[model samples]
Target: MTDITASPAGYDIHNPSITEADNLLGQYIPIHYHFQMLEDQARMTGFKAALNYLLADGGKVLDMGAGTGVLSFLAAQKATKVYSVERQADLVECANALLTENGCGDKVELVQGDARQYLPPEPVDVVVCEMLHSALLREKQLEVIESFKQRYREKFGGTLPIFIPNASILAVEPVSADFCFQGYHAPIAFFEDPGSLSTRYLSMGETKPYAILEYQADNAIELSFDGLLSINENGCFNALRFITKNILAMNLEQGSTIDWMNMNLILPIKHPIDAKAGDQFQVRFKYDAGGEISSLINAIEVIKA
Candidate 1:
C-alpha cells in the first residue's frame, strides 16, 4: 500500500459537504448513465452473485442509488423485503414498471428520494450500493456509504448493516503505454468514452496496492505511497496504471471476486524512464481523493534506487 498524506490545497472540486440531495444528475443524464452501467455485464453479474449469497436467508435489504432497480429485483428473490431508493423520479417510474413486469412489485418498495435522507420503516440487514468509479475518483460511493453507516449507527445503536462490497483496494503499476498518446502522455478522460482506453501494454511492472478503502471509513483528502521498483530486465516505463479490487461479499469458503467492467485509469508520467536489467528505482506518488469526474490530478516522482 502507498503511504497516504494530506493533499495540497486547491483540489477540492468534489464537494466535501456532500449529501443525499447531491445526487441531482437531472433527468436525461440519469437514464443514459444507467443504460451505460447496465451494459457492463461483468458488473451486473457480480452484484447479482453477491446479492444472492448475502440475502439467502430472506432478510430485509436496502438498495441505494438503485438506478433502474435491477439489483433490488435480484435481491427480492432471497430478501424477505427490499427497499430501492433513487433520486430521480423518472428512473423510479421506469423501475416501477419493470418491477411490475417482473412480478417483483410485491417484494420490493421503490422510493424516489435521496438515500441520505430517506429512511426505511425499520433497520435493514444489508445495504447495497454501486456508485463506484475507477480508482474511487469522481463518484459519491464513499460519501453515500459513509452517510448511511453514520445514520444507521446513530439510529440503531452499535449494530451495523452488512455492506455489499465490504471494501475496495486501489492498485498502481508502472507500464509502457506509449501507444496511448503521441508526444506527452496524460490521463485519459474515461468520462467521455471508456472504450477509447485499450488494455494494450508494451511492458508492465509489478503492482503496488494503495488506498485500501473500507466503505464505512471516514473521508480522506489524499493518498501517498513510497516504494521501490526493480527493473527485472531492461524496460521503458511511461505510465502508472490504476486498478480496483472490490470485495463484494464474504463468508464463502472459496471467497469471491467480481469481474466488474471498470476501465483502468492510466496517468502518463511526465518523463519516461529507461533502465537496465536488475536496476532499481524509488517511486513516490500522491493522488487527490476527490469525488468528481475530473479528480485524476496528482504528482509523481521516480528516482534511481
Candidate 2:
C-alpha cells in the first residue's frame, strides 16, 4: 500500500478523484466507438486473460503504458497488488485520481517514469501492455514489451503473457486525396527521383498529427500494395494499396478478414483529387517468401492458378 500523502515527486496530482480522473484521462482512453472498431478488443478482455495467465490468487500484475490505468483498474479486481507504469506526467496524475477515488489507492502503485528504467521491487507474474501504435508508429510496443519479457524470462522463466505480436493487415481506398499528393507535384518524388525537388513538400513542422486509425487481421505471410496510387503530375503518392510483408503476430485461417490500422498524415498544398471515402476497395494478406510471384491478389479475392 502506498501512502496517499507520500511526497515522492510531490503527488504531481491534480485531484485524486474518479470524476476528475474520468474527464482528465482523455488522450489515451480510446472512445467507445473507436475501441469497438479496433481489431484488438483484448484491452478489456485481455485484462481478464492476464489473471488467468498469471496467479490464480492474483499475485501481482504490471500494466506497462497503462494510460489512465484502465487496465490496472481491471487487474486490481483480480490482483492482490497492481503496479501501473505510465510515461506521461499528466496521465500519471489522472490515474492516481481515479485509483484514489475508487478506493484502490492502497492496492495500486502509480509510477511516473519510463517503464524501461523503473524497475519493480520484484519480478511480476503478469506484464500487460498495449504500447503498439498503428503499424509500429508513435509507439515502440515490441521493444518495450520485449524488454519486459526478456527481464521476466531471465528472472523467472518463459512466464510472459504476451507471447505473440499478431500484427494485422487491412486495405482500403482513400475517401479523399489527403493522404496523397503534396504541393502542386507529388513531393515524395524526392525519394524516388530528382528534379522533383522543385515540386517540394510541406516540412514535418507544417503537418498535422499522424496516427493509425483502422484495424485489420492477417493469416497469410505476405501482402502487396500494387494498385492505382494517387500521384500528382508533380510526383507524390497517397491512398497506397497497403500491402505488408514479414508483418508480425498473426493467427487465422487462410482468407480471413484481418484487422489493421490505417496511417494518417498531414501535409501542405495537398492536391485536390477525387477519392470518395466510400469507394469500392479490397484488402488482402498472404504468407510468401523469396519475392515469389506465386502469391498475388486483386483484392479480398485471391488469385489462384
Candidate 3:
C-alpha cells in the first residue's frame, strides 16, 4: 500500500475550460441538443411508460420545462388536460407546431414561461419535469421542483402533485481509465454513456451511494460525503466515477420500478494513487445540486490510509 498526502498541483480534474456548464445555464438550449435528447430511446421509453401508467385513470398534468412537448403529448393521451410550460421561445414555437400536427391541441396547452415560476390555473394531479443532468449538475431540476412545491403548498394548501422520476440515487466509485485518445492526452471530466467501451472500473473499491434525492420532499441544495473506501485490488486509482440512477416510477403491487438511463460521469483525479489490496482511503466531496462542475472539482479531497 502507498500513502498519498495531497493531490498533485496543476491538474484540473473538472476541466474548467469545458463550456458545457455555461451552455446549460443559458435561457434556451440549442435545437441540436434537443434533437440529441429526442434520440435517446431509453430516456423516452422510460418516461413514456411511467406516464402511461400514472395517467391511466384520467387526470390533469403539468409538464414543466417541457422541451418540444413530447412528455406533454404523451400525458395528453390519457390526461384530461395537460399544461406544458417552456421558457424557450423557439421550443415553444416548435411545440406549438407539433401540437397542431399531432391534432391534440385541444388536450395540450402550450405556455411560454419559466418553469420555475409557472403555475397552473387549477391544481394538477401529476407533474412532469425533466431537467436532468449528470450528478444533478448544470441543470435546475431540483431547483424547479422545490420552487413548485413551495408555491403549490402556499396556493393549494394540500399535498403536492405526483412528480415523474420521483427520486434519484447518486453513487461514486474509484477507477482506472485511459485518458489518451490517438496520442492526444486530455484528462478531463466526461460522461460515459451506458454500454460505453471507454473506461474501466477498478475492482479495488465498492461503488458507494452518497446522495439520495426525493422530488416531492424538501431537500438540501448542498451535498457532502465523507467516507472510507476499502481498496481490494492492486491498481492505479486515477479517477472517480459518479453514477445517477433515476427512479421514474414505482409500482408497489408488482414491486417494480421504471427507471431512466443511468448517467455515468468520470472525473479524473489530479494524482494517481498506487495501492495494494489492503489499502484504504478517506474520500471527501461536496457540490451544489444545480451548480457547475468546476465547483465540484475544487471541493474533492482524498487521503490515503
Candidate 4:
C-alpha cells in the first residue's frame, strides 16, 4: 500500500498545451507503440470490458485514442453511432479501414486528431478512451479523456462514460535472462546505458491486494512513471507494477495532478542469498476497488535456464 506519489512523481499533462505533449510523447508513441497496438489484441480488452457498461441506446460515442477504432466499432454495436479519434497519422488509416472491414463504417467515424483537441460532432453519452498503461506511466490516460469529458458537458449536459480503472499490485520473480540484471550482467555489474532493456510495462503477475491510488478526469495533462526491481531464481531484476483505477463520469477542468504509482520489488532483488536455478518461488499480488486480474503463473516462479 505504498503511495505512488512517493515513488516517482512526474507531471500533469493537462496543464501543458497539446504542443508540449507532442514534444514529449508524440514520437515515442508511434515509434515505440502505436503500430503494435493496432495489431495487438491487448488494446481491445479495455474496449471489450467497456461494452458491459454501454447503454443500449446511448447515441454518438467518442473513442479517444482510438488506435484502430476497434472500440468505436464495438461501441457502434451497442450505441447508435461512434467517432474514433487517433492522434497518430497511420493509425487513423488503419482504424478507418478496420471500421469498413467490420461493416460498421456507416455508424463509425474516424478522425486523425488528438482527443484532447477535438470534440465529437454531436454530444455523446459515452466518452471511451483506453489510453491507460501499466500503473498509469506510459500513456496520457487521465488527461485526454478528462478533456473530452469536459467538452462533452459543455456541448451537452451529461455525465462522462469513464468506467472504472480498477488496478492492483503484483509481485513476482523475474521471468527471462533479460529480467536478471545480476546474473545476466554477472562479473560486469555496471550497465551500458540501459541498452536493450525491455520497455515492457504491465504484465500478468501473482495476485495480492494492495491500496494503490486511482485517478480519472474529463480534462488535464496528467502523466507519470516509475520502476521497481525484482530477481529471478538465478537472480535477475525488472519493473513490477501496473494501474487499475476506476474512472467515473467527469465535468472536471484544467490543472489536475497525475500522481505516479510505483512498486519496488524487494524480495528477490534485495535478499542477500542468491537464488539458484530451479528454486521454487511465489509472487503475491493484490488489487484495490474490487477489480479482477489474471497473470502468468511463471512470473512468480523465475526458473534459471
Among these predictions, the greatest TM-score belongs to 3
Which sequence of candidate numbers ranks them by TM-score, best first? 3, 1, 4, 2
- List where candidate 2 sits over 4 angstroms from the true fold: 1-57, 162-238, 241-305
- Relative to the true structure, candidate 2 has a C-alpha RMSD (angstroms) of 13.7
Instruction: List model 2 lDDT by residue over 110-158, tens digit each.
Output: 8976666555676665565555433232344544554565566676675
lDDT of 2: 0.43
Best candidate, lDDT:
3
Question: Per-residue alpha-carbon lDDT of model 3 for 29-52, expressed as tens digits?
Answer: 554577678888899899999998
**Which lDDT tens digits does candidate 1 get at residues 112-163?**
7877677677889888977777777665677677777778878887677778
> Which of candidates 1 and 4 reaches a greater TM-score?
1
- Residue-level lDDT tens digits of model 4 in 43-77: 35544554644445656676777775767777888
Candidate 3 TM-score to native: 0.88
Q: Where does model 4 exceed 4 Å of error?
A: 1-27, 30-46, 162-183, 186-305
Clashing residue pairs in candidate 3, if any?
Answer: none
Quickly count the clashes in candidate 2: 23
Cα lDDT listed for each candidate: 0.69, 0.43, 0.79, 0.46
What TM-score, to 2 decimals, does candidate 2 have? 0.46
Between candidates 2 and 4, the one scoring higher on lDDT is 4
